[model samples]
Target chain A: MHAILDADYLCHLGFIRDGAPVVLPTLYARVAERLYMHGSAGSRPLRCAGEDTGIAVCLTVTHVDGLVLARSAIHHAINYRSVVVHGVARQVTDPAERSTALNALINHIVPGRAADSRPANAKELAATAVVALDLNEVSAKVRTGDPNDDPEDLALPHWTGVLPVQRTYGTPVPAGDLDPSVTVPGYLTQR
Target chain B: MHAILDADYLCHLGFIRDGAPVVLPTLYARVAERLYMHGSAGSRPLRCAGEDTGIAVCLTVTHVDGLVLARSAIHHAINYRSVVVHGVARQVTDPAERSTALNALINHIVPGRAADSRPANAKELAATAVVALDLNEVSAKVRTGDPNDDPEDLALPHWTGVLPVQRTYGTPVPAGDLDPSVTVPGYLTQR
Candidate 1:
């Protein structure tokens, strides 16, 4: 399957130091064959639990597994996963370099989306901000599949099965101002 | 909308804390008009860092968005949204009310998934464990879109539109061992 680094799948990436969580809504990263963000401006939406806000940065992403329906209600469970990165996030300041970073940001959220959208203008660039965090300290953890049934419950007359869950996409709705001649991109058709 | 508490849905909930995440395969919970999980056997998933060992737990759920299609690209993004809770989960081990708490968990996840599924037996009940948190803090964030565009490019006249995302459950596959005589329940059919 072709890979997509979408905002919806990306959990918030976070960093915590000295008992605090540093939220970075947009910390560009690459893992295996994927990239992700917390969807929105992570840093912009961060609510710090500490007073000393110098230059803290963190990365976090989550995947949801609805629930595990077991024969015995108590044995029922959930399957899900997530990752978090803790470290220092320095703001990007170089003008030429920052512009390139913005493209990375756009592409990171929707690969090739940068080309579909306009490149940031000088003023827009100034308004936009980027943070670079070294992925030195990171963690990935996951829980997958059914509940651990007791050796005895195996014989119960109840029905036992897993309800597989999958996300689907629908037809696109064009922007109101879109030209009447505009046709929806096929790429968007599947989503 | 009816507030139904599904034990399955509550069991699906997990969180990250202390930088490491601990994900339980299953936990008891309730599903009502709104979802709620009482502090119990839950442990902080992010108790450590690095690999699976460092992650105490990770919470994830996928809400289906429709399907995505790109004439030129196969890269598809699920139009769904999810939230991850990471933190330290202390077992809710009060000797007295654990049973009621377990029922709460069932109702919270699926409103009636617990009642629909088999109930916990005696030995199973004694073995059942619940995780709880004294610091009940969580956040909900989301995103929705087709594609973003630059102001000037709007006049360029390239076909631009948003593919809406939706999730629809397929026919429920029943357990093979069950009696074919039992038809699917009303909730399962409409859902």
Candidate 2:
């Protein structure tokens, strides 16, 4: 649950269309056992999927923790955690549910962001299409710790360890055209 | 070119099989204009793709730079830079090129790792299958700066700014079975 919720970037979405595979990277939000995503109403997948029939889709998120430097090149590997979900995606048509899904998407990127931002207007809501995928078949795979090197190769004169990778918050940059009076948000500083 | 080279983590690989789309997350290295990857000899994509005949593939790498907190939820967005490459992937057979490609993969994760690690043995080389995709049809999209909020919503009592995201190298953790005499590598400390 934590791994799925903590993912910060985009999700690689896979689906089939016209007897060929198509994959897209898009922003995603998790609500209960469902993942929500929004795109332009005219998007290819959304149109081809047919609002009622839905489409078969697969979503995956990955976080690389470190590089496992082993004594032997053959044993070299990366420490990572990943989650994959296979499900059918259907469009969200209800206006209220769509707004909630949209808010979930915003807050997923930055907590408390939805409350701070204005709700979508009628026109904006009409232009956006929301899709939901139920988390039925989901799997998480994680690899941690150090590299597994060969016993004979250990004595070789070589250095080996794990170089950790971390993602952190950098200094906030306000909009250039903003009013000078507006200050940086407190939530931004907490990160 | 910069976006493709500067990516820090994994790449999302997409391909079609049996009229369905399949997407996988894998480590990738870029050498000149060619992207290299390795997998088991029996892997689905590798075996199904065939050795001489290539498979149509799409590779994408993304770096999230910031969270765009807007005054309105409808305008909320993420600041990111991503590169997408569409091409045919072919197997690498020549031993010399295979060795070079493997080294490129190692050094891609950790700059000086290839020199520090032992070269792959003949058996290990036989077990691994390397593939390369040329960077011909590639495109990069970037969104930077701050959120674009509506003019009417500015006066609303809400905070808005860009929360920057940065990925950095952390302290290296030594292997549990590592010999005490072996110290952390200097190249890793530099990161």
Candidate 3:
């Protein structure tokens, strides 16, 4: 579960809003047994979490590793690694905990980034809402290897294989206002 | 919205379960203004949608374009294209609609794939459940360009830029039982 959660920094957060289910993609970071996600202070999920009882949420992170093609359409599948957490997310009001969660979110994107970048100011922090969900009811599911085909269908004259899908990073395009002297950091290049 | 939905086959589906929101990653295909997804007949969401008036769901598809790094932690963001659909998904019982939905699901993964693979048998179709949601209440949100950093923070001696992220496909690995004579299909290689 830890490995799957740490592999990606983005997740889909689901919560009920006005008797309807709402799913939104947001940035997330994992710290030990807790998962933290932040958004604008005025966001619906954040506001609901701040109520008397925190909102019940189901946070999921999925990594599509490959496409499994089989001889039959019914047998086709996708190779993926996913982690799902079911819990009630509460607003992080403590100053120390909020600071740690914010730093973790930054570092989660690019390792060692929190130290290299400027920390959030008081005004900036005030405009953000951070929520925490404990990883107690977390489960990790994975699907790998070849496509599953029936023995009778093996000779059906159809191509059966796994199309490996991977996430690749291209050259970093520097900001227009960046100074020429500021070279690309080792953490960014080494990844 | 059509282009974004057609670019990816996997989606995070959210629906209310026991008064709590549950998000699960599943395969989806978009045909015109309707979205189709399928799973086992016994699945919770499928069973719920098969009930009286169907089930309210929020289906979302997100493509992470790049990582935006800013001088300040608060300004960091992700460049992405996302489509969210909020509606009631009902189970499809008509044989014709089910067949079309299944074909769309296969072709959505790889164009021209449905023709190459064998069609599902009667028993296979009986065990599967297909659901369709009209794209009536749909919204597409996108974020692009450079990171938004304050003018004062631009010269803070920190690296700021956009790290482009793309999905790449590797060579197809054939299944062990696949006949050696069945070469890789053009549809898979062309992509």
Candidate 4:
């Protein structure tokens, strides 16, 4: 399983409103099994699209940076990477399918979470929507490492190096009113 | 200073090529301050007759999922929130001004790391492109806590609660073949 590079990069399946696709940033998750996402079968936009328009899906970008390293000026390069995915999402109309998909997404966030919390009842199920898409046509672009210094600059006295950039999560400050004894779960503490 | 509620939303900054607007993601950071993102210089789309058009951006997002308590279904209501800032972007062209803007960005990612790393040299500066935006037009949305079930399911008794999602960082794995005795820094340990 690939580590989730960033939470903001999570692609939560969404439809084009009026015209363009709308992606929500917090949809990214990591799973040992196939990654699952939210798609709605009855979403107003999905149901109205004609055959020519085709099933629509969009991805959300969470993080991007143009890193500039220096030794000399001319050898500079833009060191960056990103995630992109394309898919035709179909809303899962069947009840059983919705429940399973929701669980998969919950587990997609953290395995065993669905069990610890209650499963969706009929109404809750209806309240939620699930968009299903084949886990294909996905690609990730990653770039790392240091500045590309010219051979001539190798002996220069000036400093040269990479500026490390990454996302850092703070201690999970539980809901303010949460009971003090509700220990910070081990999974969260691991961060 | 507002937290970008959702960085997944994409918008056209200006006209480029056919209809493309240099398609960039919604990922943003408020480096100058937590919420001082006001950079609106002009109004609406900066259309440039025959020349390329640009935008005056000054927006951001904020998502906050508040605490919720529910004894059973129907009694549950979530307390969550998020924000999004959509607007045009401005290119920081002035030499000194551009440098200041970029340095803010570098420090935003790593507190003291910017000071610790080597500064960009002159030739390197020309290669880097920097953009600034304002925090004017924006929106935020949120969802939180338990599911609303019919009054009947409350007595049926399946454990009911909220599932939280979080992010984590793993131990930093260094590049191989380096000195093994290099001590891990305190900043990393805090991470």
Candidate 5:
């Protein structure tokens, strides 16, 4: 579960709004047994988390590893790794914990990035909202290997295989206003 | 919206379950203004959609285009394209529509794949449940370009840029039981 959660920083957060379900894609970071997510202070999820008892949320992260193509359409599937967490998310108000979460959010995207970047000032922190959800009710599911085709369909004139999908990083492009002397950091290049 | 939905086959589906939001990652295909998804007949969402009035769902698809690194932690962001659909998803029972939806699901994963694969048998179709969500309340949100750092913080000795993220396909691996003479199909290889 930890490995899958740490592999990606993006997550889909689901929460009920006005008797209907709403799902939004956002950035999240795992810290020990808790997951922290930050968003605009006025965002619906963030506001709901600020309520007295917090808000019930379902957070999920998925990685599509491959496309399974089988001889029969019914057997076609996708190889993937996913983590789902169901819990009540509460707003983080402690100064120390908020600082730690803010740093984690930055480092989650690029390791060692928090130290290299400027920390959020008081005004910036005030505009951002942080919510934490414990990893207690978390579950991870994974599917791998080749396509599963029926025995009778094996002789059908159709290709059966796994098309592997990979997330690749391209050359980093520097910001327009960046100083030429700064140079790309080792953490960014190494990842 | 069409382009974003067409680019990916996996989606995070959110629906109310026991008064709490439950989000699950599943395969989805877009045909015209309707989104079709299939799962086991016993799945919670599938069963709920079979109810008289169907089930309210929020279906979302996201593509992480790049990681945006800023000079200030508060300004850090992600480049992405996402589509969110809020509507009631009803089960598809008509045989013709079910067949079309199944074919769309397979072709959505790999173009021209439905024709190459054998159609589902009667028993297989009976075990599968198909749900169709109209793209009525659909919205697409996209973020691109470089990181947005505060002007005053640009002089801070920090690296700021966009690290591009791309989904790449690797060489296909045939199933162990697949006929050696079948060979890789053009649709799979070309994709």
Candidate 6:
């Protein structure tokens, strides 16, 4: 569960439309047992959510931790943690839930961000669209540790190990026109 | 074109099967005008590619670069570079091409890795599958720079800037069972 919450908020969402499969990468936030995805009113996936019959969608998030190098190419792999959720997505039309869901999305990316940022105004809320999916039929998979090699190949004189992949935050780059008097916030330094 | 070539080799592939859409994350390679995805012979997406009629698929890769913090929550966004390809995928049956594709896939993740590791044996080749898709319909979208905030909200006394996201390679961890004499290769240090 911590993997699901701590991993990046980006996800790949897939659904069928017009007899063909379509997939897009989008931002997503989980609030309790529900997940919400947001976009402008004109986005194709968001439009599909508004169809009379809700869209059946699959959303997935993955974190590649390291490359598992083995003596044989056949056994080479990546150690990763991933989550997959299958559900029917419907457009969120209620104003209150939309605000809450949007806030969750914002905070999920950066904790305490929702309180610092100004809430959306009525016009902005009307232009933005949110889709909600119940987190049912969800599964998480994780792989770790070093490469698994066959006994015979272990003596084949090849380097074997894990090249760890890591993500970090660099210095904050201010907007070109931002006021120079403004200082970086405390929340941004936590990461 | 560079975006497609430089992105991480992992991608989310989407395809329709039995009137339902399925999506999965897999390793992929780009050789000239074609993109190839690899997996075990029994994988569902690879199996779908073996059908008489090619399977319609969408493949996507994304790199999130920053958190776009805005004065208003509605304007908050992520800076990212992404590529999406829509095409029909077919199983690669030619043995020579399969071998080349497999090598490309391996090298895409780590340069010179294919040359260092043992090539797949005949038995291993028989148990692996490769799917190829032409890079005909592909589009890349990128967002960079600072947050986009409304003029009114720019003066809202909230921090506004971009928290740059970065990925780095950490020290390699050798397999517990690796030979004590084996050393980390120079290729791993280039990262």
Q: For residues A103-145, what per-residue lDDT tens digits would candidate 1 score against the true structure?
A: 6554554456556644555655554445555556666666665
Candidate 3 residue-wise lDDT, A1-191, digit = tens = 99999999999999999899999999999999999999899989998888879999999999999999999999999999999999999999999999999999999988898998889999999999999999999888999999888888878989999999988898999998899889999888987
Task: In model 6, state the lDDT of residue B143.
Answer: 94
Candidates' C-alpha lDDT: 0.45, 0.81, 0.94, 0.44, 0.93, 0.87
Better of 1 and 2 by lDDT: 2
Q: Model 2 misses residue A190 by how many Å?
A: 1.9
lDDT tens string, model 1, B1-191? 12111212422333345443222323434322222243322323312321233322333333334323221111223344444444444444465556666777765545556567666666656555554432233443454555444454557545555555443455555555445665555555566
- What does the lDDT come to for candidate 6? 0.87
DockQ of 1: 0.27
Candidate 6 docks at the CAPRI level of high
List model 5 lDDT by residue over B1-191, tens digit each. Answer: 99999999999999999999999998999999999999999998999899999999999999999999999889899999999999999999999999999999999989899998898889999999999999999999999999888779978998889999999999999998887988898887897
Model 6 collision count: 0
Candidate numbers sorted by DockQ from highest down: 5, 3, 6, 2, 1, 4
Higher-scoring candidate on DockQ, 2 or 5: 5
DockQ of each candidate's interface versus the true one? 0.27, 0.68, 0.90, 0.12, 0.90, 0.85
After superposing candidate 4 on the true structure, give the runs of residues whose Cα lies further than 4 Å from its correct spot.
A1-23, A26-36, A39-55, A60-82, A144-191, B1-51, B55-82, B113-117, B141-191
- The stretch of ten residues in a row with the least summed lDDT in candidate 2 chain B is B1-10
* Candidate 6 per-residue lDDT over residues B49-161, each given as its tens digit: 99888789999888889999998998899998888899999999999999999999988898899998989999989999899999999998889988889877777878899
- Runs of candidate 5 with Cα error greater than 4 angstroms are none
TM-score of each: 0.63, 0.94, 0.98, 0.59, 0.98, 0.97
Superior by DockQ: candidate 1 or candidate 4: 1
Q: Per-residue lDDT for B52 in model 5?
A: 98
